[model samples]
Target: MALTLALESSSSSRGEGGGDGHGSCRPRESMFEKVVTPSDVGKLNRLVVPKHLAEKHLPLPGAAARAGGTVLCFHDARGGEAAWRFRYSYWSSSQSYVMTKGWSRYVRDKRLAAGDTVSFYRDGARLFIDCRRIRRAGVVPAVPPRQPQQAFFFHNQQQAAVQPQQHLVVAPRVVVVDDEVEEARRRRCLRLFGVNLELELRAEPLLLDLQL
Candidate 1:
């Protein structure tokens, strides 16, 4: 493209016939004309459409007579262009302006969704439009670390260790004793009491003899 532009520039300069034999050349006019500038472009309007608009015609807001039943050209970032038709009509005592044809194709190609914004512009004598897609902000929760299956048992042990005194209470145990063992304990007690009584009676008789 640069080479093409350079060649066109050289050819236009040659066409001016620059030969006065005094190292002088006639001034030549620029072959390329200035097209639309950034300041010349302005956003005419913006529209936020719903999902249903993709299948149905898109309604535009403006003077119906100016845009009614007229063809507008759209240019994309890739320099590709497509022609779309604008239609205006009256329905039930109300006027409506819409893009009747070529709209569905543009929407499908761009994969537009609900909440997506579309803006129209007036550049020179041409109509141009651009789209801005709306995105939702989301947050993904963090997953907790997994514990082993035996964690429950270890958790109980940890609780017990934290309060050692609470786990130190001993439960009483029941024992069965034989009748022969009970009888032997009773006989031993009787023998010890019987010997003490006999000694006391003998000491009383000696005291009576000394008094006489």
Candidate 2:
């Protein structure tokens, strides 16, 4: 079956199968992506995977695995193993498949929020998760500009404040060739003598020599 795994929106591509191993192996292509919702990044502490994608791509937990949920190892975008293994389980009450256990830590470290897209890919037995952040128009930075560090000393009801470090701004020095500077000076003199600057600038050496 053809898989729509490209990172591009609504694009599809076929990828070669990889060996079934873990550690340091990157997936050839993405399998599918899900747009994050508020609940996914909220206090729910779990991520709800689409039933179709979960059934097709994720391995179903057996009775033993279901006791606590199967541990699913996932690699980050850089192909490195994620810090924690996610627990995959079917939630009968919600009638959905969700990633639990380590989901909240993943969301926190990745700083994922609603509207961000998370793509899933598999290479052999290794699975990967990549995040694509949605850009917001006219969004201001949360942290203010850093101010100079302050040092305060208090002794015998007296306060002494340390001065802030001085920042020096060095202007760029222009390099001028002596010959070019002299040529420009001569040109200015010629212009003062009613000589056209353009004519002098464009004048051929042979023509100027002849005129001279």
| Top candidate (TM-score) | 2
lDDT of each: 0.28, 0.51
- Residues 3-39, candidate 1, lDDT per residue (tens digit)? 1112122233332232212221123221111111111
Alpha carbon lDDT at 108, candidate 1: 42
What TM-score goes with each of the models? 0.31, 0.52
**Candidate 2: deviation at residue 1, Å?**
27
Candidate 1 lDDT score at position 44: 18
Per-residue CA lDDT of candidate 2, range 8-125, in tens?
A: 3222332323322222233345577888876897778999999898888885755733575688877664443343579889877777889989887776666565556677877666
lDDT of 2 at 195: 10
Residue pairs of candidate 2 with colliding backbone atoms: none
